[model samples]
Target: MAAAFHVRSNSFPSRPHPQAVHVDEQLIRLRSSESASTTSSSCIGQRLCDLQDLYDSLEKLLRLPVTEQTIDKKAVDKLLDGSLRVLDFCNITKDALSQTKECLNEIQSILRRKRGDLSSEVKKYLASRRSLKKSFQKVLKSLKATDGDESLPVFGEAEALTISAFRSLFSFMSESTTPSGKWSLVSKLRNHKRVSCEAQTANEFSELDSAFQSFAENKSENPLKMEDVKRLESCVQDLGEGIESLFKSLMKYRVSLLNTFGH
Candidate 1:
């Protein structure tokens, strides 16, 4: 276990690349699994390092005269080739990172626009809110039965409550030292006093609050609210829309995250 932890904390091994590009303005897109993370960033950092090493070595060689083949031509060629391979990997890493960033950005934009539709400053839309509540309830019900083709990660209840306050899913893949673990993402934390007995690893949508909270980004001290709508009706409508979109985004995120870690 300790060894696994060390592996998580350690950097990825620098892989070799062949026939690397020399362009300065190039950028790579990020993969969903790699976005908003130190793990992916570490790869980028290593690539930069390899590039710098190559530059330095070339500079030294330029200044030094060719006397009796310094350290054998073949060995030098191999070293240079290894460095070049790493450089190529770095380029690919950059592209993957960029793509992930773009995907996250797109998801955010959709939510933002939907949020914009919720800016009416009134609070008495219980009817509309209730309608949305029902829609989500139905969605949850279906999920509870495992009524269709699917799998689910039911984070036990206690941990979810913590998520409610924080509004962010902690990345085990990025932070975890090991590649494997039994509780990669716990559904709940049981030690807390407020957590209910029913917060066990249930399959129902009763887990919604905690389950949903795990995917939220970091929450500030002040909670988010709606703003800028022509009427309270639109605000209410937008609220439902925004929430629906949120559910969609989270579902997507969960899948992407699993796929990433699975790889």
Candidate 2:
């Protein structure tokens, strides 16, 4: 007998944009013997498509100016909507991965029971499972750090920090940290850490947090000047590069793991 699984694309909530990009729902039926290979490949394909769509949306959003006058609020809202869709899709992918991992674990357990031993192939399969989980975790962390929670600021505090970091990165701001800009002072309250684990990224994020706090203190603000807009644009470009690198690493590992099932 074969088992059947259906993966559906999630529809987004209404926003400024009336329509969201369309993604197809996929249904895959797997024979008992083919369950591992078939399900893994099908799910991987669906996830990849969703991720590509998200990357495209972000790339488009990245083009908009940060300042008020020239800024395209409509485009910004559209991109925000797209980001929410991506978040939903990633959650779906995570669920599918969980189920797949559980299925593999069950099979591994049964094999161990029947043979009273684990073979070389079984060991390799288990290793792949662990690797997949780690890779997926990285993907989730990076996306959440960039996408941020739903709030008025659009770019969440973390994103604000990222923007702040970019200003310093481009030498648009002084290198000296404002009193509020210290990581311990600012980041201790935040739950999420910097997207990348590296020290340099962390330092950049710290700078951003400080800069954002300073901005907050100022209260009154003006539309971004042209120079500010250009600087923020450069910042987004830097951020996008990092995001692309993370996604590429995740895709490569995930595909490699699925291939272990000989897809």
Candidate 3:
């Protein structure tokens, strides 16, 4: 019996622990599902939740003595670097969401009072969005430049997925809500009709953009609607809450990894 048990244990010498295998499967499923569809706020939120779960699983896995010993110093170093980048991305995204929320709140307040020059407020908000887009572009360029190697082990794969998810989030945010080319107010009014028709098929960001665009183009005749402002405020609040949760998860995961491997 002893000899039979020894033979059976040696037979699975190279196989990963069951929990580790499960985590790998989770990663594969996440990557496959995300790749099969376009990015949306709902999808992004789901992905963040899934990633947080994965990180929690990984933290548990790292507690295993075999997992800790299996990971080399080089791999740990890679994880540390990747963790820093992930945190940076999370912070940038959070900042963007916060700034957007603040701007929308200001617009909402102005609309509620029906007193201020709504057009000027809309312009300020648009300008802030433009600045945000520029910042996202720069960060995205750097992300692409550094994304050449992703051959690390399980932890490396997780980091890559985190980066990819953030890239998609940033790309989605950077997209123009309005159509290309500058239009005269008359032209904008004409385009607004088409935008309205398409808004039903649009994402939250697009909906908010169309609302602001319509208001900007017709500020002389139509005041900024409170309903539109409220819709956008709600969207920002949802995104802020999701990102904040993911940020906390990422921080905890990074700290856990550092504690386990930083020696």
* Best of the candidates, lDDT: 3
Pairs that collide in candidate 3 are none
Each candidate's number of clashing pairs is: 26, 1, 0
- Candidates 1 and 3: which is better by lDDT? 3
- Candidate 2 lDDT, tens digit per residue, 1-263? 00111111123123322111221111111111112322111122222333344334323333322212222345345334543444443443445334434534544464446543333333443354355446555555555576544422222221222222222222211222323321211121112222221121223322433433443445245211223223322333333433344255334433432333223
lDDT of 3 by residue, 1-263 (tens): 12211211343357768877878777886687468554555555566666777887887877776666666676667677887888888889989989998888888788778777778888898889889989999999998999878345567778778888888788878777633332211112111121111112235565567767777888666656677667656656666666777777777877877888765
Per-residue C-alpha lDDT of model 1 across residues 1-263, encoded as one tens digit per residue? 22211111233224311211211111111122123332221232222222233333333322222211222344334333433433332343233334333433433354467553211211222222234345435434443453232211111111122122111111211121222212111111111112112212221111222222332333333233222111222222222232333333333433432333332
TM-score of each: 0.28, 0.25, 0.82
Question: How well does candidate 1 match the true structure in TM-score terms?
Answer: 0.28
What does candidate 2 score on TM? 0.25
lDDT of each: 0.26, 0.32, 0.69
RMSD to native, candidate 3: 9.4
The ten-residue window of minimal lDDT in model 2 covers: 1-10
Which consecutive 10 residues in model 1 have the weakest lDDT in total? 150-159
Off by over 4 Å in 2: 1-71, 115-263
Higher-ranked by TM-score: 2 or 3: 3
